[model samples]
Target: MKPRVSILAALLLVSVCAKAQDVNVEVLQRDLDHPWSLAFLPDNKSILITLRDGELKRWTPGEGLSAPIIGVPKVWAKGQGGLLDVVLAPDFAQSRRVWLSFSEAGKDGKAGTAVGYGRLSEDTKRLENFTVVFRQSPKLSTGNHFGGRMVFDGKGYLYIALGENNQRPTAQDLDKHQGKLIRLTDQGAVPGDNPFVNQPGAKPEIWAYGIRNPQGMAMNPWSGALWLNEHGPRGGDEINIPERGKNYGWPIATWGVNYSGLAIPEAKGGKVAGTEQPIFYWQHSPAISGMAFYNADTFPQWKNKLFIGALKDKNVIAMTVNGDRVNEDGRLMTSHKQRIRDVRVGPDGYLYVLTDESDGQLLKVSPKR
Candidate 1:
């Protein structure tokens, strides 16, 4: 069944009292099973989408969605572990290279996040020369909290965010890959200048540690700073600027409490001496997932603003960013009532969002004519 498109006749308000331009939410595709991420091809019209069920598909406005592209690697599609993120190489137009992050299996039924790249066939029907370049260390049996978001910074370095795999203490363990942000060359080689390269017993790829479950990562186009958002225990969802060699306090200092409604034992009321503090946080978690920064001309009013997908809140959060500080502007698509999985700013300057559901949908938010 085709999902209904919602085109609001009334202008969408950007803030409590300030009114914004009218916009419409149009369903571009429907019946997607757990769509995780999307990347716009150089053509700006074609898109590659990854499904959590371990399939990659292509979609174009008039051509519709293609059959699952072949040659995808095997994924441990259990719990939060599965095929998660897909992005094109910075030189994709010349390289035809595509990168992917997914949950891979290990001995004793353990699993961890893995990354690889492959060339997209000219026909867009298969991936060629796919190779696994990196894998998270010490795979565990737990099935939750696999942070699989991948981002390429202005310097052509790739950053991979990882979850703690339900083990909180590991966030502070440099020896473990869980709950850490890893930086690597495009080919997955550790840079000699990495913060932990000379630190014994630490993973050389470790860029920063003490993250809980980072689901949103993006490089700000204006300032070239890497920004991230992660889930908190009961509340305290946060927006952080991840810097090299910095430690982001996770379980040790969070604005959230345990699921049992109890205070975190190690947290000194959500503040720690040596850990970096979040630029912005929510006392009530929104379960943020994807991140995008608007630097386009299509929506002049939204220029330089940040957009984040909210899973639990089921809305797209719009935040105004000035330098390193952020403030909530408003929410969008609240009436849709679907868990937002991913969001991106298309080459045409429109906003594309994916809804997380059994019958998921790809929606485009454009100015209503």
Candidate 2:
């Protein structure tokens, strides 16, 4: 069944007030139940979507939405845990393999982030020989802050972002996998050259540590480096280009205060030894989620800009990147007032976003012709 968009009257007023003129938003699909992520298929017209309720479905331009695909692994659908990011393999054309990150539930109601990959069936009805390749160590009882975004660098390695599971101090612990970025081979094996492979107690998969709850990951097209965006407590959301064997100083030193309106004890000095600083940070947190770079011919004016989804302001934040420092350009789609969950530049050279809500939507943004 095709669902129609029901634009609210207040949204119409906001459109008139905001003057968003560069691109116009078209509601492609509506009535989604808290959709989390989307990945454009190789064909450019088809996309695979994941819902927080643990359903995997495919959408095409002509056929609308297909029935939920089969062979999804068991997910813990608690507070902030569920089916999350979906990404295609770097060599998906020949391999037909796709990757997924979700909250893997364990015994005693504990759960943690996990990464898995499998081949799509010929008919697109099921996943064949699905396997959970990696699971975060030291599973916690908290249900929030599962940083499940994944990005492939076009090199042989794939990177997965994991949160600290609401246990702040754990971000600094190398003995545990919490609050770290990990790199793995296409088949989930640890790369021999990974920074901590020789460390006796450190996990060999860890590429960088001391992140809080990162929800966005992307490879910079020009620099060939990995970048991430993570949520802060009260403020101080950060954008960092994670380096191998570096500490990002999460609970130990953050610009944000505690949620109880108190200062974080470890962050008193604001600078810690041997920790890296963020390339950019938000004094007023936007609750940033998805990220993408605009390098498409469709919108020549938006080229070389980094686009991030802002949940707190219910809009898409655009920034101009000069080398590493970023300056806020403007906001997009604030008229819709929806929590933007994920953002991507489709193979067709257009921007696509997912709204995070019970009655969410998939929207396509294109230059106004």
Candidate 3:
């Protein structure tokens, strides 16, 4: 049976230099169970999607969604811990290798983020020889804040973003894996030139530290810089370009107050002495997630712009990037009324988005004729 297609005409309108821009949103697939992330296959027509409930699925046009691919690692599947992100290997066309990041369980109910890889069987129904590559150290008791976003850098090194597991002070600890960005080789070995590889008490895989719960990460196509967005307590969501050995103050310095409406005691102010500042931050956080850069010719007006998913704000933010600085251009799909989970630029040059809901949807955005 063919999945129903819904056309939402002119769902986005943005004024650009006295001209009105119209966007068309087409529903591609629906009824996903809290879809977390998506990556396009080499063919560009097929997609791999990860559900928060620990299922992996493939979607192809006309064929609808495929059955759950077998051999996914067991996930905690509680709170924020579950199957989170998926990406194909840099040599996926010849390798058939797929990588995954998820929350893995430990003794006494503790859990932490883990990364693994496996080859997709020729039948596309199972994973073969799946091997876990990395696991966070000192698994904590909390289930929330398992930052499971992963992206490969220009040099093919895999970068993994981690959360503090609701344990705030750990964000400042170099000895802990929580609240850190890690860089490792494809097989999960620590890169020798990493900033902390020679440091006495730091994890050799640590690329940067003091992150909160980063849910969005992407490599800028133009500059080859790595950028990420993370959640804040009550406000102060941030977009940062992480550099080697840099510190991004979390509990120690922030623009957000606690969820209880009280100020965070450890935080002195928005800027601390040694921590790097965000290029852009939201005073009232939108709960940002996945991100992508628009370098496609399909929408010339959106060329070189960055698009980020907004869960709380229920819109996709378009930002203009100038060197290390970013400016908000506009918001799209504001009237859609769904939590945007992930955003990616398709191989065909259109924008693809995933809505985070039990009845979530995959949407394709293009210029309205």
Q: TM-scores of the models, in the given order? A: 0.93, 0.93, 0.93
**For model 2, where is the 10-residue window of minimal lDDT?**
1-10
Model 3 worst lDDT run, 10 consecutive residues? 1-10
TM-score of 1: 0.93
Question: Each model's C-alpha lDDT?
Answer: 0.87, 0.85, 0.87
Candidate 1 lDDT, tens digit per residue, 216-260? 999999888999999988987778888898888988988889889
Cα lDDT of model 2 by residue, 275-323, tens digit = 8777777656789999998877877888888999988889988877776
Query: Model 3, 311: alpha-carbon shift in Å?
Result: 0.5
**214: Cα error in model 2, Å:** 0.4
List clash counts for every candidate, in order: 0, 0, 0
For model 1, where is the 10-residue window of minimal lDDT?
1-10
Residue 92 lDDT (model 1): 85
